[model samples]
Target: MLRAGQAREDIKVVSFDVDGTLVSPGFVDCVWLQGIPKAYAEKEGLSFEQAFEYVKSEYDKIGEHRIEWYNIDYWLRKFDLDIPYERLFKKYEDEIMIYEEVESVLAVLEEEGYELILSSNAANEFIEFQIEPIKRFFSHVFSATSDFGEVKKTNGFFARVCEILDVKPQAVVHTGDHWVFDFLNPRKIGITAYYLDRARKRNVTDEVRKEDDEFVISDLSELLDDPDC
Candidate 1:
């Protein structure tokens, strides 16, 4: 347990994004980039390459950070694809796996009595069907579409989440892989943000350019190792 002063310094609420943070993004990549394209090819009688190009063209128009881009139902309806997106995601459910250190880290945090929240832009059905194995660990699971109808890329999303959790922004710490959505926006609202850069990739958002120092962790285990985060 954290000492009195330590508890005050430590985050009261620790939030994490699902994809590319708690879990590997391989399954989502496979579904959107590969599985859907193959299905499109079969449905449209177009060659795989041609179908992929068509889907990518339409997908680009929405832009990834937008709420519509992350909406599986919207994509299915827009693309006119007869197949359910949830079915496609479940086909690759085995691949939607959590990192090796994820369980251990969450266990430690839970033992330490931090309020853990799983914040993700993923469809609620996707969370229910794909990452269900790890759902037991989180105190609350928040989906952008189902929970708030908003994407985490904006400050409003953070504000809404803080309101739902009934905690001040300064008392929370959010960690995720996206340099913009997860790290920058939360920090803008006074939440402590940690970028989980497992690959050590460079992501210089406007805030990083100005502050010149960004909090980052290559592994979830690093959170346990840090005495002062």
Candidate 2:
């Protein structure tokens, strides 16, 4: 089931990784662990359990390698929250779910012509309200921290997403659920990465990188069961 490039019909562009591989890390963990600490506990009158432990210790003092930690307008202007990231994305945007194998695997990879893309580090204004119910099955939506200021997904952001999808890192193919920005930064350059570990939670790629690289894939319909995918 791991037969990459089965007969090499030249896999043209397939990247995807919007929140836990096409939606459902409970809308970016309910907009950063309960909508920015319930909008800083209604502007510092404090108590959504003490402003989510003081906005999760100021988001662990700026973690996620700080591109303003994936910038929801830089935490609503760093908690000067007069609230308006579109009313905290219309109150958690119903905690966007979207991953029952993501619209039948993006309608079987855009009906098998394969040109979907959404390669994310989530910050095109938080991928536009959870990518608006699959955003017309993507022809491009990249936002390694808002379209390549890259605070994640390096390998020079998969070589500038194969130089703006003029495709050639082996014709591209990516999956997600992050084992180093969706599996070792787009397989470090030659694309064709896949490592979606859906709650099989870390075989840790057989303990750190390429031990005969099975190109793991807990399921996006097993990327259409190979057949020269």
- Cα-based lDDT for every prediction: 0.78, 0.78
Per-residue lDDT tens digits for candidate 2, residues 7-89, read 34788778888887777788778778888898789888888999999888887899888788777777778888877777767
Give per-model TM-scores: 0.84, 0.34
Model 2, runs deviating above 4 Å: 1-8, 20-23, 32-35, 46-70, 76-78, 81-118, 124-145, 148-162, 168-219, 226-229
C-alpha lDDT of candidate 2 relative to the true structure? 0.78
Residue pairs with backbone atoms closer than 3 Å in model 2 (clashes): none
Instruction: Please state the error at residue 189 of candidate 2 in Å.
Output: 22
Q: Cα RMSD (Å) between model 2 and the true structure?
A: 14.9
Model 1, runs deviating above 4 Å: 1-10, 203-214, 226-229
Q: Tell me the tens digit of each residue's lDDT in model 1 across 1-229.
A: 3222123465688888888888888888888888888888998899999999999998998886677887777877877889887689778877877889988888888888889888788878776766677777677888877788775556788888899889998888888998888888888898887888899776546446545343777887766655665
Looking at candidate 1, what is the lDDT of residue 136? 78
